[model samples]
Target chain A: MTVATSDRAPAPAAPDGASRPTPRAPRRRPRRGTVARYAVLCLMVVLLAGPLLWQLSLSLKGAGDTLYERPPRLIPTDPTLTNFTDVLDRVPVLRYVGNSALVALMAVVGNIVGATLAGYALARLRFRGRGIATGVFVAALLVPIETVIVSQFLVVRSLGLTDTLLGVVLPGAVAALNVLLMRNAFAGLPDELEEAAVIDGANAWQRFLRICVPQVTGVITVVAIFAFVGAWNDFLWPLIVLSSEESYTLTVGLNRLRGTFYDDPRLIAAGTVIALIPIITFFVLLQRFFFRGLESGGIKG
Target chain B: MSSSTDLAVRERAAAPRRPRAAGARATHRWRFVPWLMLLPGLAVVITFIVLPFGNTLRLAFTDATLLRPGRWVGLENFERLLGDDRFLTALLNSSLYVVCVVPFMMLLPLVLATLVSRPGRLMGFFRTSIYMPVVMSSVVVGLIWTSMLDRRGLVNETLATFGAIAEPVPFLTDRWLLLFSAMFVTVWMGLGYYMVIYLAALANIDGTLYDAAAMDGAGVVRTFLSVTMPGVRSTMALIGVLSSVAAFRVFGEVYVLTGGTGGVGGRNLTMTMLIQREGTGLQAQTGYAGAISLVMFVVLGALLVVQLWLQQREGRTR
Candidate 1:
């Protein structure tokens, strides 16, 4: 909320001297609008969070409470964490969590390295075929992932990477959006910063690391978050690639909860809650960087 | 700095030489860098994106199967698609989903942006609440919605208590209602992300315009129509195109909700599911699926181009 105030500096300042007298004359008018705005926002908050809260409440219920419906209760008459325990016992929840974490970490590392290098090359270096390359990358953005699924499956099988964590992580490691984001962030850096380093006898790699990388740290964080979430939440590719239950990611594991539906409603709700945790954590951690990066990038130029 | 001075003196000293040649050499050097930057990403795109696209294009023209190999059938797959009733149903369902959802997705975010633009105390909370679902995995969101919209789920239970219905509605399984339910879930999940994009654009707006409009005695609605809307028109255009593409390409919701059966008389089926079922069904028809995908690609590609074209026009208009 404090962030809103920082943004407000430009708001009042934009009116300046011409409207200075007007504000004094009608200070109450702005307050009225502000109050109305807050009311609308409060409604939106309920709309957004209401369902999620319902899910949380359901997850806390005992199995009997879920099925006993003259009407479904918002708050269970008798609550239990036994459902969470049941889910933990029936499925390899911890292993799936580890697999998701491993895949996300590898993808994030791969994307950051590959995108930063590509971003720097596009942003700094002068070379032949630059325009053509940029054009191709932009055009590639619309290539639907579904169109390539079969071929990608074949490609992975041929490489003998199928069913391995690497198969899922590798294909997603370098994305056009990340490269584009990094390039835009790098472009905003002053030329003098790079030139000054070049005069000091820094090589291309050194200049990128010492001068440009620091400047685009915010974009790097944004790209990493995107890559991590993309890998973490992905299901179709992992489902296609991984054959064994021991190797299944959280999404595959959660999907299996559908198989166990008749077992217990408590377990089902518990599993649903468990599946949402990493996603919620991932977003909360990265949103600070995400918002800051977009502000700095100027809405994709 | 010293080397730059030396280089400047050398360049000045070499002014009599082939200066045009030096400038051209530098330009050529600069050109290679972008290609270098593009190489790894291009390789990924080529392998993961272009090669598959090429294969799908070729496969569309052939009689391919998961087993028994493939032969060049030359438009037979596409010809079959034209007459296929299920394909038409899927097409209609997907089209309706996009049409129904895009307006809500686009408008709600704009409304949200307008509300949050006032520099309120809870604006961050508002932005975060909306965006929470965007960052969540589609699969998890699908699972969550499944629970929330189940017959005995919270939504129906809530409606039942209010006596909105005599009985709990078959929200997911009902033929007439399934697609709407899915669209509602999709919009609920996506609203926050588009809001962030709108907020970003709103942040860039010059605040003086609002005061100017106020001085002219325009109220909130008038100011929003004439000032705020135009100010963020480009972002709105971008979000519109992105959300439409998202709506068209939606698979997770349909897959999870209807389990690729397309629910009640195949009414909830989408093009992506049809493509999946064809490629991977019990009786695998890779060539037919490939053909369907090609049609989808062409339709989407044309729409995307139109979207960009409209965005450019709108941007210029603003």
Candidate 2:
């Protein structure tokens, strides 16, 4: 799966002198740069897309086609979408999608509300215990989610939220990293605006919503996309929390495609591709925002 | 302006007296504002993340098996770890992975960012194409690569056609190849992410630096070395830390690639895998897994501190 760090490439900048063919080319190129660039690009295509394409081929192939006598064809000879239909029929695919969507939505909302409020306070308010809260968060970064799984499970179960969408979403609604990112974004905004709003009889909430929130829409977009991707692609927590088959998310559901459609690799690949399509689109759409967010974050933070 | 100045003077005049009289009331009322706003997040962090971490630490110290009550074993778990060959192997494998992947991931992104930063007409397309894999989950990546590395997969088929080898290379089964394959997949997955990070840093770099360098007739490579590289030094350090952390935590690819065995003869069992295997593998030795995890946590902590120190030093030097 795509790691979070990679998805946040800096947005392309508007080039100065868009038409200038500067004389710097000869200085940089040793002939190998071109060769190396092509080589890397070719390698990138192969390495990045190879598995995805292979999965597609295998998924479409008929039974016993995995080790085809002829070298594996890129496309299936029969070219059937049967695997997709088969996966749809064999298991509770819709239910799994619903569960994943519900959990992810809740996670997004929860993270936004919790992280935004915390970020605002940390950014604007001067209060006691701020230092301690910040320290707690930074410390939380070192604590692997896996290390706390059992404890979280216990706590969720005790709270009666376990095995439900709320259970899985609530625990992860806020994270230290999100807080840090949001704080960075908020800190960059001019403080004068908030003070002006306060002077104009705007309450704290109003000023934050109208003034601070708009100023940091870029960061908010980044956070929302991150939460969505994280919740959607999440595996371990969902695996632990959602015991019922009906509560399965896409990641778990796709994994089930392996056993249910045992002989059919097409079904699995189709399932993977289907799952990946949305995620890839999401990344592309937000690529511009994600890059800007990271770039500003690095400098200001 | 006079009114504002008067108010400021009044506030300045009143500041000393108000602190003694209104300080108690103001402090009490304002103190809760930040805390109140922060409570919800704090609750989640403590309940889910923090408590769970504590549980892991506690669990590590006890002789607990799955579904069994743990007995306090103090340093025994830590003591047993000193002799854990598998732990040692996983540690070595993870180190090797970090060592190899970090430089490649770091440099490739720097290069790719440079290339795409000013990509003439194809900038958007090239950037998007490069970043396509940045959104997919690791599960999908693992599944995809497994399909490719299969015996009759594309790489081998191409090799066979070119007569590059007498036989198809067993990519997943062979130990070194398996590691390489996993590393390759990891780097591919990682490149676009860091590329974006670097791209962002590059955007912030004052274009005038390049202009200045060019005015001085400095070569592209020289400008890059003297200007761009130094300009993005802090960002590079940040990425280095992040990349190292990721490398040290290598698990998912190995788990999916070799199905948690780390390929033939446990050649690829990373510490995370070892801990996971002990916890849920056929053995299900939670205590031992917890112990392995504790060792790993220490390793991670030590490595992170050292990395931070190195970066701080580099920052100062720059």
Error of 2 at B245 (Å): 0.7
After aligning candidate 2 to the native by TM-score, how far in Å is the CA of A190 from where it should be? 2.5
Best by DockQ: 1
- Per-residue lDDT over B1-318 for candidate 2, one digit per residue giving the tens place of the 0 to 100 score: 122222222333445344322212333334465677788889988888877677778888898876675899998987887787777888899999889999988788897788777644345666777777767777677767766676766677767767787777989898888998999989988887898889878878887777788678775578779988988887787787778878888877777778545777776898776765676523456676777767777767876787678778877886
Residue B135 lDDT, candidate 1, scale 0-100: 69
Model 2 DockQ class = acceptable
Task: Provide the overall lDDT of each model, using Cα atoms, as 2-decimal numbers.
Answer: 0.73, 0.70
Q: What TM-score would you give candidate 2 relative to the actual structure?
A: 0.84
TM-score values for chain B across all models: 0.85, 0.83
- Residue B163 lDDT, candidate 2, scale 0-100: 78
Candidate 2 residues A279-299, lDDT tens each? 777777677765665555532
Model 1: residues with Cα > 4 Å off, grouped in runs = A1-36, A63-72, A293-301, B1-39, B281-283, B314-318
Residues B85-201 of candidate 1 have per-residue lDDT tens digits of 889988888788778888887788888877765443355667888777876666667767777777777777778877898876887888768788788879988887777778778
How does candidate 1 score on lDDT?
0.73
- When candidate 1 is compared with the true two-chain complex, its DockQ is 0.40
Worst lDDT 10-window in candidate 2 chain A: A1-10
